[model samples]
Target: MLAAVFHENGGPEVIRVEEMDAPRPGPAEVRIRVEASSMNHLDLWMRRGLPIEIPMPHIGGSDIVGTVEKCGAGTVRSLLGKRVVVDPSLDYDWYRLARLRGYDGEPFRVIGEHTQGGFAEFAVVPAANVVELPDGFPAETAAAAALAGVTAWRGLMTRGGLRKGDRVLITGASGGVSAMAVQFANEAGAEVFAVTSGSENVRHVRGLGADHVFDRTTTDWGREIHRITNKRGVDLCLDSVGEAIWPQLLRALAVRGRLVSFGATTGPAAKVDIRLLFWRQLSILGSTMGTPAEFRDAMDMVFRGKITPPIHAVLPLHEARRAHEMLEAGEVFGKLVLDPREARP
Candidate 1:
C-alpha cells in the first residue's frame, strides 16, 4: 500500500509517499480500499507537531471515503462491499458524560492523529465509525465534506444554537469549516457575515450565501458588522481565527450572544476582557467535532445535497506533498481531495 507519511514532525516537506504493508482490521473493525481522502488544517497542524504525542511514521488524512473490502471479528457482515465515509472523531458513550463534566481521564482520539489514517490505498477503522454512502454519490465530494461538514454543523448549530433569522458571523470564511458554515447558516435562514483575505474570497463567500462578506485585508470586519447592524452585532459568531481575531469577535457579538470556536489557526494566545462576559452577558464556548448523531446529520445533508462544499481541486494520492504545500500556503479556496486510484502502479 502507498501512503503519505512522516517520520518526524516539521513542515510540509517532511511528508512523503511510500509503500507500506497494508493494515488489517481488528475485532469490530473493517479495512477499506481507500477510494478518496481529503486534506484538512488538522493534517498541517499534525505535520508541524502538536503538544501531545502521536504515532510516528504517521499517515495524516482524516476525511476518508472508501469501499469496505473486509470486515473483522464481531463486525457486521452486511457492511462488506459497501461504500462508506468515516467519522474521524473517535470517542465513546462516555463522551457525552465526560464533556458535560469536563472530564478527561481518557483523552479524545482522532483517526489520523492517534492511529493510522486513510491517506493511503488501504486503511482500517472501526466498523462503527463507517457510514454507508448512497449509490452514485461522488467519492471526492463525500471525502471533502466529512470532517469539515461535521465540525461546522456542531459549532454553528449545536453549540452556537443558530436559528432562523439569526444574524451569524463566520470568521476565516475561506476555510473548509467556515465555508461550510456559511452554506449551513444560509440554509438555516441566518443573515451571514463573513471575513476573508482577498476580493476573490470575499466574492466566493458571498456567492455561498453570506449576506455580508468583508475582505479582511482592507476592512475591519468587526467594526463593519457592528456599524451595519446599528451596534446590535450578530446573534452568533463562529470563529477559528483565534488569538489575533478573538477580541474583535467577542466585541462583535450581540448582547448576551454566543461565540463558538473550533480552532486556533492564528496564534492561540488571546487577551479576553472578563468585564465583557458579565457586562454584555455573553457566552464563550469551545467546540470540536460533533457527536455520532451530528456526524450522521452532516453526511445525510451532504448526501441529500442540502449543503454543498466547494472543492478546490482533486489530486492524485502520490501528490500528497504538493497538496500539503498548497494547503499550508493558504492557496486553496476550498477542500483539496486525493484519489487513491491515481496513486496505484
Candidate 2:
C-alpha cells in the first residue's frame, strides 16, 4: 500500500507518498479499501502540529468513501464488499451520556486527528462508523460531504435551532463547512446571509442558496447584515472564524438570537461585552463534529439529494502535499478530494 505519511509536522513539504503496510481490521472493526478521501482544515492543523501529539508517521484524511473489504470478529459479515462513508466523529462513554442528555460532552477526537486515517490504499475503522452509501451515489461526492456536511448540520440545525422564516448568517461562506451550512440553513426555511472574503465567492455562495452574500474584504459585514435586515438582525449566526470575526457576529444577532461556533480558524480568544449578551438575551453555543445520530441524520439528507457539498478540486492521492498547499493558501472554495485509485502516468 502507498500512503501520504508525515513523520514530523511543520509544512506541507513534510508529507510524502511511500509504500506502507496495509492496515488490518480489529475486533468490531472493518478494513476499507479507500476509494476516495477529502481534505479538511483539520488536516492542515494536524500537519502543522497541535498541542497534543499525534502518532508519528500519520496519515490524515477524515472524510472517507470506500468499500468494506473485510470485517473483524464480532462484526456483521454482511458488510463485506459494501460501499460506505465513514462518520469521522469518534465517541466515548462520556460523549454518549452527554449526547443522550443533550448537553456538551468532553472534547472528542476525530479519525484523522486522533488515529490513522484514510489517505492510503486501506484503512481500518470501527464498524459502527461505517454507513453504507446509497445506490448510485458518487464516491467522490460522498467523501467530500462526510465531514463538512455533518459539521454544518449539527452547528446550524441542532445547536443554532434554525427554523423556517428565520434569518441566518453563515460566515466563511467559501469554506467547505460554510458552503454546506448555506444550503442546510436555507433548506430549514431560513433566509441565508453569507460572508465571503472576496467578490469571486459571492456568486458561489449565492448558488448554494444564500439569499444575500457580503464581501468581507470590502465592507463591515456585520453592519451590512444589520442594515439589510432593517436593524432587526439575524435569528442565528453560524460562524467558524473565531476572534477575528467574533465581535461582528455578536453585533449581527437579533434579540434572543443564537450563535453557534464550530471552529476557530483564526484564533479562539474573544473579548465579549456581558451587557450586550444579557440585554439581547443571546445564546452562545459551541459545537464540534457531531454525534453518531447526527451523522446519520446529516448523511440521510445528503444521500437523498437534499443538499450537495461543493467540491473545489480532485487530485491523485500522491499529490496530497500539493492539496495541503492549496488549502493552506485559501485558494480552495470547497472540499478538496484525493482519488486513491488514480495512479500517476
Score each candidate by Cα lDDT.
0.91, 0.90
User: Cα lDDT of model 2 overall?
Assistant: 0.90
Candidate 1 per-residue lDDT over residues 1-345, each given as its tens digit: 899999998987898899999998999999999999999999999999999888889998898999999999999999999999999888754577686877856667888888889899999999999998999899999999999999999999999999999999999999999999999999999999999999999889998999999999999888899899999999999999999888898899899989998989998898889898799999999999888899999988899998888899999998999999999898999799988888864
**Per-prediction TM-score, please?**
0.97, 0.96
> Which tens-of-lDDT digit does each residue in 47-70 have in candidate 2?
999999787799999988999999
Candidate whose TM-score is highest: 1
Give Cα distance to truth, residue 196, candidate 1, Å.
Answer: 0.7
Q: Which residue ranges in model 1 land beyond 4 Å of their true spot?
A: 99-105
Clashes by residue pair, model 1: none
